[model samples]
Target: MKVLAVSSIGGHWIQLLRLMPAFEDVTVEFMSTKQSFSTMVDGKKFYSIPDGNRWNKYGLVKCFFAILKVVETSKPDIIITTGAAPGLIALFIGKLFSIKTIWVDSIANCEQISMSGKIATKVADVVYTQWGHLEDNKVKFFGNVLG
Candidate 1:
């Protein structure tokens, strides 16, 4: 399977990296907001998209198009993200291409799901919350990336 793994910088990126073992048998590509992160992938395919958030509309638009371009070019069979906004945009683009998408909510959101994660529950094929108490019919609890 060709997997496109995406996330923003910081905690999201850390969680995404933690899930790398799961993609050992598959072809995986990495996407993030920072170009410097490409080196961390050990020569694997890497893409960089502009970072964006709810507070930045223009940035979000740029991020959306950037993600769209990556999705079109990578043609991944599955797109997975430990998200903020860039990853969310990738998930939306993945759906448009009929690619399977998975969203693993950040481990930092212990009190509640991040806004992007909540939206991902509707856009992604599968949505996982780190907190067991947050699981429901749509959001699932499958062990967190942190532990």
Candidate 2:
């Protein structure tokens, strides 16, 4: 399957990168806010979209279209993200296209799934949390990125 792994820079990127080795026999691409990640994710396709958050409505809108463009051009079978906001936009687009979507909440949200993660429950086909306690009616805990 063609997979688009989306994340912002820093920890979210680190979490997504850790999930790479667990995935096999598929084409994997990356979407990030930093073009420098191209070197970190060498041998895979990479896209840099505008970094945005819920507080930044304008930036979020730009990122939404940026993500849509990537999904449209790549036609990925599935879109997965360790997210803040950009990945949520990808999930929304994937859902619109009837593509599979996965949202892996950032490990930093040990106390609970982030607000973005909570929002994703509405659209994501699968929602994963690094913390066992975060698993509930909406979220699933299947180990963690660090493991």
Candidate 3:
């Protein structure tokens, strides 16, 4: 199966890389923002979508189109992501394309729910929470530290 793992740079990027071993036998594609951390992902099938901040409207448009192109070309069987802006876009596109999606909320939101988690929980096919106590009918408690 082909899986596209998406996440932002920094901590989220680190977590997503941990999922590499799980997809070793399958085709894996990665998408993330440009950063020094991406250097660690050498020798992998990957694409870097320009990071979008709230203020960069032009950049956001460009990145959105870039993301669409990647998803269309890759046609991943499944999409998994950790909370970040790009992940939200991937989740929406994946669902629209009938691709299976797994959205894992950030571990930092241990007590109160995060905005990303809230959005993903409403849309993702499978929603995972790092904290067991945050479990709900629509969420699966996968314990902390997914990556």
Candidate 4:
């Protein structure tokens, strides 16, 4: 299966990278906001989305265009993301394309529902969380599953 792993630049992206080996048989690609992403995950297919910022209008616009390009080119069978804004956008796009989407709640979101978690839970085909209390049926307890 073709997979698009979407996440932000720092820990989120790193966590996704850690999970890569498990899906070695699937064709995989990445989408992130870092300008120097190629240096971080070399020799892999990658698309850049603008970094998240509540005050940067231009960044948001750039991200919109970037998302359009990503959705068109990747055409992935499954789109998975570790939380934050990028995951929210990817979830919406995956829904539109009828792609299977799995949202992995960030390891950081221990008690409260993050912005991405709230949105992704509403749209993603599967929502996996490390926190045991995310009792929603569609949300699975995947505590430390990446390791």
**Candidate 4 residue-wise lDDT, 13-67, digit = tens:** 8778877776789988888887687676676788877865557777766776687
Candidate 2 C-alpha lDDT tens digits along 50-126: 98986899999899999989899999999999997898999999999999999999888989788999999999999
Ranking by lDDT: 1, 2, 3, 4
Better of 2 and 3 by TM-score: 2
How does each model score on lDDT? 0.93, 0.91, 0.83, 0.79
Q: What TM-score, over all chains together, does every model reach?
A: 0.97, 0.96, 0.90, 0.88
Candidate 4 residue runs with Cα over 4 Å from true position: 145-147
Would you list the clashing residue pairs of candidate 1?
A: none
Give residue 55's error in model 4 in angstroms: 3.9
Residue 69, model 3: Cα distance from true site in angstroms? 0.2
After the best TM-score superposition of candidate 2, give how far the Cα of residue 112 lies from its true spot, in angstroms. 1.3
Report the number of the highest-lDDT candidate. Answer: 1
| Two-way TM-score contest, 1 vs 2, winner | 1
TM-score of predicted structure 2: 0.96
Over all chains combined, what TM-score does candidate 3 have? Answer: 0.90
